[model samples]
Target chain A: MEKTINLTLKVWRQANATAKGAFESYEVKNISTDSSFLEMLDILNEQLINENKEPVAFDHDCREGICGMCSLYVNGRPHGPDDEVTTCQLHMRKFKDGETITIEPWRSAGFPVIKDLIVNRNAFDSIIAAGGYVSVGTGGVPDGNAMPIPKVDADEAMDAASCIGCGACVAACKNGSAMLFVSAKVSQLALLPQGKVEAARRAKNMVAKMDELGFGNCTNTGACEVECPKGVSIANIARLNREYLKAKCLD
Target chain B: MGTFFSSSIGKKFVMSLSGLFLVIFLLVHLSINALLLVPDGGEMFNNAAHFMALPLIKYGLQPVLFVGFIVHIFYATMLTSINNKARGSVKYAGGNNTKDVMWASKNMYVLGITVAAFMAVHLCDYWVPLQITGNVESTTLHGTEMHDTYALVNAAFSQCWRVALYVVGALGLSLHLTHGFWSAFQTLGASNSLWRKRWTVIGTIFAWVVGVSFSLIAILQHFFYQA
Candidate 1:
């Protein structure tokens, strides 16, 4: 038998970027327990559309959770109440029948709300544009074994690389810091042999760009790590600090 | 260095260094205060306190300690203002995180202010008379004259309210250090996944030990001091 549950959603509503927002309550019935949280929202949108109402707007792409687009502050958590999953990966079975869910946009000076639940995460792009890439001369592909990398280093780098640039860390942080995101970006590169050439500069520029974009400093609270869907460690943050210090003090 | 201090991590670096310096000073201060419980009629504590008042420590280490405190407070203020701006005026209407964000970690500035407020009373009870006003009663032990810091401390502790305040202050200090200790190391790039958990455990133990001992000394002095 298919399991379905009824839910009340106090979804945030706003006409435009400049418009003030508020929670507009609506009842969603018979949402399948197996449906992804975003899909459930899709059902709600379909219902609203049939009723000739302005549907709730949200950001989502690549529902498999790779694109980092679907953002929703579900209840009190950034991605509903699930651990290690984005909104698209969150299943409706996590909620009880007739549960009231309050949805919100990411609230931070660096991430302003554009519409109902869509926030401006362009600050992330700006930080990346500042120094998230390596610049090297074009050349033919080298043999895979040419550069011998440690297995431990490869694993750690992969762990950091898993961050999907979801603003959940920013939304979840009490201080509204983007340190986890910036740190993950820096660490994934800093750990590898190919990225060693521009490690120091990458750390400095990315951090400076983050600060310039109104992101707060890391207080080392571990909140970002716990809330991170990718489970990226704050250890990356420690590494970023090391790299940034090398650029500023040693260099 | 100037350019370094201007960046976000640089400012955090300042906080970490200053906070660690203060952490060390706390241990030293607590050890000296613990001497009051020696059951030796304040002799050991007075001798120790007098040595601290010597020009070598009084003029040298004392000014550096003041700078450590000032720098920590300055950076905290600066960072808090910047963080508030980053958080913006429009607050989250209803949000609650299930993850256990450390209670002290969230309210560090407030805890710091509580400790600072307690320190104000502490300075008035000791530093004002002993260092600035030269109004503290003096005694010559053996050959050298020193401010009777033991007497002043005993007098302050004898009051029930003051002793209670010390207990509260000690708890505040513990809460602050619970986060501040490991956080300092983390900011300095000394902590990792393996070490971050270790530092947190060590920090919590260190916080409680110092806090409980400081309160015990005060309570014992309040009830048993022969002054």
Candidate 2:
């Protein structure tokens, strides 16, 4: 067995919004292929901190793939070479020794770089803010199954709700469009009986907010689905379009 | 403006119409380019090229194609921007690890942008040079500078690397089309009880044929053509 393998990493280093950025190479020695991709980065950051160099700042909350915060574009692919996992879940086993991995932040006008590996995904919040929530007042004591939605609708709603809002769809998009995310959110709620009261308004507000955030349009490239961890259907986008059209034309 | 635009169906209707229009253009383009493979004497290719370049056709139809291109791009841009603003500051967890949605649809915008970028490159390679500079220094078919515009077509596609680029661009276009085609129809009211699954399959096949056919012509000509 080979005891040690060398790797070259070209990580993006931007001190702040005002500073120009460039790629800095670092050598990682003797890494086990079994190590998670983030674990490899942790090893690198530990080495940097020990050497008194400021560690590379990346956004990661849960080391598991559940949190969308661990955003990184590995070798021109959002979230490494693997098909559907987040950067945190990507294992080094997928890569060969001595491979040069190019790591960069999400490139989108809407997703501005906050620092190394951190992007302000506020664009997502605004879309939800636009109409993501149901308009029920507080202190509701309704039963869990008050309204009986169709089984198919319930199942589909569950599917749409599975979207974790990880900006992978945005990062993966060439035009930086967020239709997948917005549509998923809109469809999930709109599918439910509880969400009926404001379905039209919800679709309109969310879509408009999406447009305002500078994300590129969706031309159905499907790269988002190829990269989406949640497997959100492009059908949701169709649903979103339907909802938006209906809401728009009724007046 | 704000009132109706705020509805879900309204957006879907526009997106669907625009998408259908673009799909029609793709079919037309694919059929036209497929003429290059018609075989024997290059008669079909010339006729098709001449048909397209006729003074009436060029003058009368160029403006319409231009408008189609603009509307397709414009609505796509507008819808995307609105979604971004609406979903501000939240991200869904799951990476290549996410087990739910298909990766292709999630990254539609990315693929679209790639196709658009490559389209620009392709247009420059063929359309601009051939149309703007009519001196025709590239490839000449028999004696007359490949009049029938055959010279320009061969010139742009004959190179090995350029052929490779065309293949890659076609891949991007295919990826975009496969997901977008039926999806747009679905949004426009085709998501009925019977035709949804059928259209999805048809859309995928359509994407492959158009994309591969357009790209295959370039590759075959570069590798196997005897001229």
B1-227, model 1: which lDDT tens digit per residue? 77688999999999999998998999999999989998877788999998888899999999999999999999999999898889866777765664878989988999999999999999988898988998988878888888888888898888999999999999999999999999998899998889999999999999999999999999988888856
The 10-residue segment with the lowest total lDDT in model 2 chain B:
B90-99
Q: What is the lDDT of candidate 1?
A: 0.90
| Candidate 2: segments with Cα more than 4 A from true spot | A1-4, A137-146, B1-183, B186-197, B203-227
Q: Per-residue lDDT for B1-227 in model 2, tens only?
A: 55443444455456667677877878887787777776654566766665676678777877777787677677667666655653334232222333333456656667878888888997786667556665544323443333355556766677778888889989888888777877777666456334667777998899898888888888876766537
True contacts kept of 2: 0.11
- Candidate 1's C-alpha runs over 4 A off are A138-141
User: In order, what lDDT does every prediction score?
Assistant: 0.90, 0.75
